[model samples]
Target: MELDRISNLENDITQKIFSYLSIKEAARTSVLSKNWSHKWIVPPCLVFDDENGLSTETIVSHVLLLHNGPIDSFKLSSRKDLDPNDIDQWIHYLSINSIKEIIVKKRNRYSSSYSISSNLFSCQDLTHLELYNCLLQPPSTLKGFGMLKSLHIRRVTVTRDVLEEVISHSPLLEKIILCKLGIRHLKIDAPNVSFLELRGGFEDVELENTINLVEVSIDQKRGSTNSSSLLKFFFKLPRIERLTLQDSFLEGANGSLPKKLPEPCLCLNFLSISIRLNNLEDISTAMCLLRSSPALQELEISVQQDQHVADAAEVTGWLNDKQNRPFTQLRILKVTGFSCVKAEMDFIVFLLLSSPALQQLEISFGRKAVEVVDFSWIYDNQNNGAFMQLRLVKVTGLSGSKAQANFIRILLSSTSTTLERLTLQPAASAKELWELFKLLGEFINRVSVPAVVLEFLDPSNSVQESDDSSSSSDSDDDIGF
Candidate 1:
């Protein structure tokens, strides 16, 4: 038989080949020769997600014992619980070899949470750390992760004080995400931290010193309406450029909300916030941030689907308030999770009227409309003073409802002169698709904008919005302009 070219390749090229193999598969290559033996034993990355816990643990231990080179990353994922003691030994060994990244994900969350090895904190060269459904108990001697740049903890259990200690002590930490953690009274003092995302039921949040903090997203299960806490938190982010606050985050302001932040977010160009039509405090907070964000260009508002939608009077009063007029610099406005509420429509009109620089408007309904959505108010306002700057309007989550068709009808009438594109995305299922397209197509024939191309995103072929910030859960789906 002729000699194999792959086997005779250079060590660098061989290393590349071995990188694609699993640890077990790579280890089996040792039977080839002594040269192949050493390559398999020293893989640059080790990812263990085997179903059999005992075997996985034994194999990992055996691999580490025979390992002789630096590993770029180590990931330990398991469906069945593995002994934390074994994990400790592995972490200690990886620490000595200068591992740069560590990810431990426990798939079975219904069972007991994984107690991570304290030795993990000793990995001084670690730059990225992600722990899911794990408990982090750093030793008292732990100073900080000197080279750590990103720390992500999801469904992890750590004391408020311990987490604070880990975050504040890390000098190089830039990105921190604490999601669905069962802890409270979180305090962050990361001076170098730029992106911060907190999504949980935190009783309190304190930002001691986040001077470099810019992008922030908070989707709290329950948000306090305390003015002092809100003010103190907002005052620290002078350089915030992008912000998204969703769910019940800062839902109510305890009857006393700040009119505006003293230090404006002058650098902020994108702002996303949750709004409750009935909650004046929520509206007030949204307005406060809008007023403070002078440089804001993109605005996204998620209208909470609350049954107690505010009356037209309350929406009118807030719109008429001089201080509440928002987004003078706003170019793109996106509204989502809207049900056909009188106040919701009124608020949309208010935004259209207030935002003179607005160019693109997008609205995604939360549910199929039960009644026809009246857009006569906007149709009449078109003659008085229209959004001349408006260029594109998109409406998604359509189910061929009379309400949606009527809204599109009004949009076509209002944007006939300036609109370049009118995009509609139906939320109907495969069975209902034909009916939806038929209704919309017929409606467009009767009520269409002049010379404007109509676009429809077929549900079957539609691509789901990615995790990118432009199409984030808190922002509008990124339809490229």
Candidate 2:
């Protein structure tokens, strides 16, 4: 049957069909037949894109005037300047209609400021709410967001009290993302929030009664003084499964691990942390978190560059003498931002020797680190023909270095004869591309691999798959927070 035949279905079915089309596309359906003239006015899902040459304000106003049913979801985007009051009126209309989800995006850099309407606080039916570059001054009479499930606030101006009030009211809220906002302290008491991501410059985040949380991501500045707040957050989350932390998070734990070391985080199976390992305090900080996560199976460490350098003599001495417990469950290790410094190399060697069940090692070299070392020692001196359990090896960000080349060759030749696949990629810069091929030339001739899959990724295309693996978590469908 033709589209017209399809459109001739029952009115409710036609309305459902129209819901899948853009507002403009649905409006154009009026030309199909007189039966379709009013069909576009009652779509449960309405989206207005001003960039498509439809005036968001006029379209939303017109839709509100003609819309005869509850709005299940409404999204409006404006690339042109807008009046804050206009947006307020639109929000007021949606609130009264019991809108289920609202997404407002201001795309133009020069767009006028838009402040969220106070009426939005009364939206009890809203399940998902997202706002970008808007101002939010939550009403004082706000009771709570009893049905809200996800909230994402980015580049918005919201005061600390308003933020706290909004969150406190959201009882069913499962995920929240706060980014690029100028709030200093964040205190969340939401009981059901499972996935939380906090970035930008916030001085502290205090977790009150949010007990069911499973995953947490914190990207912020680093220092020992921040440990007190982190301790409060970590101590509250006994059920956390996956945690990604920047060096700043480690700084907080560096000086404050309880003498009894809060109970081992038995549920935590994955951990990713960025650390400036040159400092003894930072190394110990990382160790502090590691010791607490006894069940961690996958560990990702991004070795960042920083100015502070602890006494190497003390760091090495501790590494050699420290009787730290091994990560017996650990199977995969990925290290990025590697600078090929002695400490970093030592750390990799430590993990290899310590992890008895280790199966895979992924090492990515940073630009500066590629030229720093003669890595011939990586496997050259080891005569123990001990077979490793490793099945996969991936080395990224390879820049030209004879030592690095030799290390790759020796690693493949000596360790884990059962290794299934080897993945190698060059550094982002074109200058470093040749270095990768130079090493690949030697490896292709001597390595014993069943299959070699060469993947060439430019800087923009480069992304750590492990970082994206968080999508496998249950809360992955929640907005990016």
TM, every model? 0.83, 0.82
lDDT of 1 by residue, 156-247 (tens): 88888888888988999999988777776678989899999876666567897789998988775434332234446777788889998766
Candidate 2 yields a Cα-based lDDT of 0.72
Badly placed stretches (over 4 Å) of model 1 are 1-42, 51-55, 65-68, 223-231, 321-326, 367-385, 428-451, 461-481
RMSD to truth, every model: 5.2, 5.0
For residues 1-481, could you state the per-residue lDDT of candidate 2 as single tens digits? 4477755688788867886788888888878777777778878888887757767678878878898777889887666777778887888888888899998877653456677888888788999998877788876687768899999877789888878888888888999988768776879988999999886576678898888999998776544235456556777888999999864666655666653356778899999987767777767767777778888899998777766666655666777665456778889898877766656766666677667788888887764643553443454334433336677788876666755665566566656456666777666653655665666666666654545444455555455433322222222122221
TM-score, predicted candidate 2 vs. hidden true structure:
0.82
Question: Residue 42 of candidate 2: its Cα lDDT?
Answer: 77
Q: Model-by-model lDDT, in order?
A: 0.73, 0.72
Candidate number with greatest TM-score: 1
